[model samples]
Target chain A: MNDNNSMAYAQSDTAQNESAQSSPVQNNSIYAQSSPVQDSPSYTNMPLLQLNDLCKRYPGMGSYMSVFHMNLIIPRGRIIGLLGPNGCGKTTLIKMINGLLTPTSGSVLINGMAPCPATKKVISYLPERTYLDNGMKVSQMVSYFADFYEDFSTEKAYGMLGALGISSDARLKTLSKGTKEKVQLILVMSRQADLFILDEPIAGVDPAARDYILRTIITNYNPGSTILLSTHLISDIENILDDVIFMKNGSLMLYTSVDSIRSQMGKSVDTYFREVYAC
Target chain B: MLGKLLKYEWRGLRFPFLVMMIVLASTTVLTCSVIYTINPNYNEAIPWYSSMALMFSIFLYYFGLIGCSIGLSLIIVIRFYNTCYTDQGYLTHTLPVTTRQILHAKLIAAFVADVLMVLAIAISLFLIIQVTLHHILSFIPEFTYADLMWEISRGIGEFEEIFGIRIGLYFAYLAIYSLIGTIANIVTLFGCVSLGQLYAKHRIIGAILAYFIVQFILQVLAYFASLPMYARMLGTSYNSDFSFFGLMSPTMNLMLFFSVALAVFMYFANMHMLTKRLNLE
Candidate 1:
């Protein structure tokens, strides 16, 4: 696996239940270990996500790329950590995945389709910023999620809200910042999506809340769904991640399994990230 | 999905609309009261202070109505910008909907709200006139509300004699034009905001500039299109035969076509920017 740099991360620590054989990597798609092969026959031959020469350049920024020609394939059911320094295009890449931003050069194919309405159904995204309407109550936000996302579980959302001691009747504007973050996190984590793309979920959150969030993400997500979380607090989330993607200057630097990193490099992802991205 | 989007859009809009309605209703009542109770006619010989207060009330009432109408438009523009372009756009864009769906929902919602506002203001004005006239006409022995309405209906016929069209038909045409115009206006505002977002560094300023430029261009086009017709009408007006509807009909038809074309152009422009050129910061 280590020798095959392009397909190094196809092995999974938790998705070993599948008996499917390894398929050849197609169109330079980011290959990951197969899981839930029989869950959907149409996507059985397809990777969960395929990025082909994806490039994005923002306007008014000359000779600079927000996301350079990045190619990656993320498989289903592994929690992958998207690690990068500030302004390293982690968010930009994630936005392209979720269709919040358009790519300049290539394509992002999800579940054998482009990033259209169907793709959005399978990708549950929690942006770094709080996107909840402040005028709405926590309960109304639940209704909103239930209305838009067919896979969203209102009962699960309300249960999590109660477990976190968040009042459903409380308006979002009245909640503390940390509490609002928790609400947004709960809204995202409550969905039963095929892919959960969380951008900086634990950033700006307290240590206790971070622990709770990481725990919730690990325990609550469907074992059939993949999780791609982006954050700078690598050490805090390093243990839960099955794979790690290191981005530098809007390009993919290294993408491999955490186990491979440990066996070959003899270092934690956090330490390796520091040495690679040190200023 | 467009229905769901419209539902949420109206949820965000209702509070502002409510406030506007309250202001409109109170000012309508106050203006009506001042008209009858204080008698601020120049020759009535009322107290100077009372007359000043009456004039102030009148000014506020008129401006208040105008402000509410214009304020509704601003609210629609700001709502479209905030939900579709700001940090909030992260959720909106990620929804399992197309860019056209979102734009269409906003257009329909804004058009409905605009029509409601116009209707409310029109009803308030009608009430003030009707109620005040009813009170004033009570002292006259033979003049009743019915009689006034009959006279008004006949006066509408005289209006036809001059304008060469029935008052009802005129109002029907006006209503149709206003409704379509409202939709075009909303689409243009949203299109401007979408166009502005492409600027990346200066979205608000870019949007404002885009609005001014669009307005100026539309004005220039309209002037050129209407100049010949107006010259022809003026040439007719000087000959003691008013070409009121003739002047209106041709230009109105031309503007109606222009308005639809502009809306379609802006809609496609917005769709292109949203789907292909999304630059959310």
Candidate 2:
């Protein structure tokens, strides 16, 4: 068989094995690649994000690099929780995947394509803090996103806003901190994308608001879309996650399926994260 | 993309732009009144027009200062103020837009605002000239009936003679200059702040100190860098025999090109740091 067919066969085999371990892919996820004209109409399996030998370095005191080489792969249709303490490179990894922070060496592929403007179109991101301009009203902010993103559904965005009881006319500056975070989340979740990288989505919220945010994430996430939710507060999101990627000091310490961790490590993901990252 | 950038830039500066307009309008009215009061026979006096010319000359300096101040303030607001890197960088770097696009948007917006500021001053001058019609006519009765048209033509001639270039070229060069100026400030601001914010060792204080140090070094470099251009503008290249506009045309054009190149260099450096090495928490 040719290179294309061989690659397709290998991909399918990997997907089948992965599916056996996790939830099945759901319909409605935008698939850009075709699987060599499927003869039996079977869905082809593909990883949504693959990080190979990724490295980032910042010059530190007298020639040391702050962040070292690291690697991890995030599969499709699973909530992969990235747990680490302060300065562990969780945010950096997320930023790299979203194309904000580029790797010093190695490569990262989003849906098998190099990070570019086109790849960004399929990645939804909610930053840890409010990034929206404080001067803008909710309506203006909505229109701004709508102008750029073709997949941004204004109707759905407003519906979500209404459901959350947020005023469309309220300026971002006037909103309370929790409310502002919700506004940002609304904007992020509004886009139907293949990958959603939420960097510390619930870090600043109270327990109640954190629960609300978690619920919002679970319900709003498009099926078949991969999610990499990075947070130190693992217990809150532990029940929903299918896998956990633990990082420390700019290195990947552990990457395993949740069930495997429970079966082997014999501890909850939260307990595992705390033990691994505890100071 | 440029248009969107300009739109957002304008959105960001709506308040400042309005304030600039009001300042221009007041200055225009005040200047006209002062000139009329000084020369009651201003309409008949040719020398009275000198004051109007002098006002524009003064405005030229103000334009540069205001442009620089606004650009500096914007840099602080967008890059330095509050000085949190983690949250801000996350949002900024992931906007589904290229780093270059973001830079272009900011540069264009700042340029447009600066241009409008200059225009506000120019428009105010035009209105004053129009309102002082009778006074201008009475002062130079020999050039009456169509003296307004004559003054306009003369003004155009004077601009060409003094600068030794066409008005179109002059305006284009100015636009380029303002754009580059804005880019420079933005780069310096972002680079320093990002460096500070990302460094786990020290944050805002370190960033600010680094910024000042960089600024001082750049200023020293810039002084030497500007020596050739300053000599050109001040030297014999400023031909007194030529029309007012022709006297310094080459120097102005050269300065414009230099600023643009410098700005582009700074722009790339800033983007490189932001995209690759940003230590967003």
TM-score of chain B of each: 0.91, 0.58
Q: Tens digit of lDDT per residue, candidate 1, span B112-201?
A: 889999999999989888877876786565888889999988888798777767788888999999998888888888888888986778
Q: Which CAPRI tier for candidate 1?
A: medium
Q: Which stretches of candidate 2 lie over 4 Å from their true place?
A: A1-46, A61-67, B1-6, B30-89, B129-250
Name the 10 consecutive residues with the lowest summed lDDT in model 2 chain B.
Answer: B75-84
What would the per-residue lDDT of candidate 1 be over residues A1-279, giving only the tens digit for each residue? 222334323321112201111212122223344322223333455889877767777876775676666667777878889987888789999898999888888888998788999999999999999888888999999999999999999999999999999999999999999999999999999999999999999989899999999989987878789999999999999999888887766766566777766766688888877866655
| Model 1 interface RMSD over true interface Cα atoms | 0.8
- Over A117-148, each residue of candidate 2 has an lDDT whose tens digit, in order, gives 78888898887767887878999989888877
The candidates score, on chain A by TM-score, as follows 0.85, 0.81
lDDT of 2 by residue, B1-281 (tens): 55664576567676766765665566666656655654546255646566666577457535744754565366434533332254655555566677677666665665556566556656776776675776656766677757667777889877866666778888887776666666665555655655565546776776777678766766666666666555655665655354444444445455545555544655555666566655665
Backbone clashes, each candidate: 3, 21
What is the i-RMS of every prediction?
0.8, 1.9
